[model samples]
Target: MLKVTPNPPVTEPASITDPTSPYECPDSKKFNEAAERALDYYLGPPTARIMAAPYCPNRLYMTNPKSSNESLLVDASETLGSANVMLNDFAALLEGTHRKTLLGIAQIVMLGELAVNQVLDNLVPTE
Candidate 1:
């Protein structure tokens, strides 16, 4: 009877047992240094090296650093008041949970405005 399958091809064993095999390096120190350099290049430093950007205020709408605290407080109060009014108007146009949420925010803004107004009232005018 004839065989359907052909005989397997013969092959040489791997050179792992040889002293100069590609698996073994003659200069281990150099190899280790190269590997470390490669790892450092790919993975970066062990510690974080993040560089923070220097603070530079926007020139277009930057607040004056020399502005009086009272003036700043007044501005803040006016902003909060406007925000509250806007929130109330928006809440009036909505219903359900969204309206309730907006109303709650408006109440908070109104409270903040009240606090600022109280501070303004307590502030003594400087000569």
Candidate 2:
């Protein structure tokens, strides 16, 4: 029987101290400063910011109630009509439960539209 042998280990001695070294220890302070500067350069705001209350309901709150109410009614009416058309189109394409559900939705939208129309008629009382 022949015996197997492993390769010998190799070792390199460390370099002695030199006055002029190519690499030096990294400066964490300088790195942090550079990172902060880079972040500021890329992420800084374009314009001066005025900080206000985060939860400001008055920002878009309607000033005139009566005029806004009328406009809202008209918009609701239009939205309901568009919804009815879409629902009808979908109902035509669907079957069974889906068809029935869509038809139900269409009926509800129509009822809402009629209610809005009645409210408008009562509010304006036009001949």
Best by lDDT: 1
lDDT (Cα, tens digit) per residue for candidate 2, span 40-77? 76687634222332444564755555567778888889
lDDT of 1 at 40: 78
Best candidate, TM-score: 1
- Per-residue lDDT of model 1, residues 1-127, tens digit only: 9999999976544343455555454475468778988887669864543333455667898789899988989999999999999999999999999999999999999999999998987884546
Candidate 2 RMSD computed on C-alpha atoms after optimal superposition onto the true structure: 16.7
Clashes per candidate, residues 3 or more apart or on different chains: 0, 0
Whole-model lDDT values for every prediction: 0.82, 0.76
For candidate 1, what is the TM-score? 0.53
Give TM per candidate.
0.53, 0.49
Clashes of 2: 0
- After TM-score superposition, the amount by which residue 41's alpha carbon in candidate 1 deviates from its true location, in angstroms, is 17
True-vs-predicted CA distance for residue 119, candidate 2, Å:
0.3
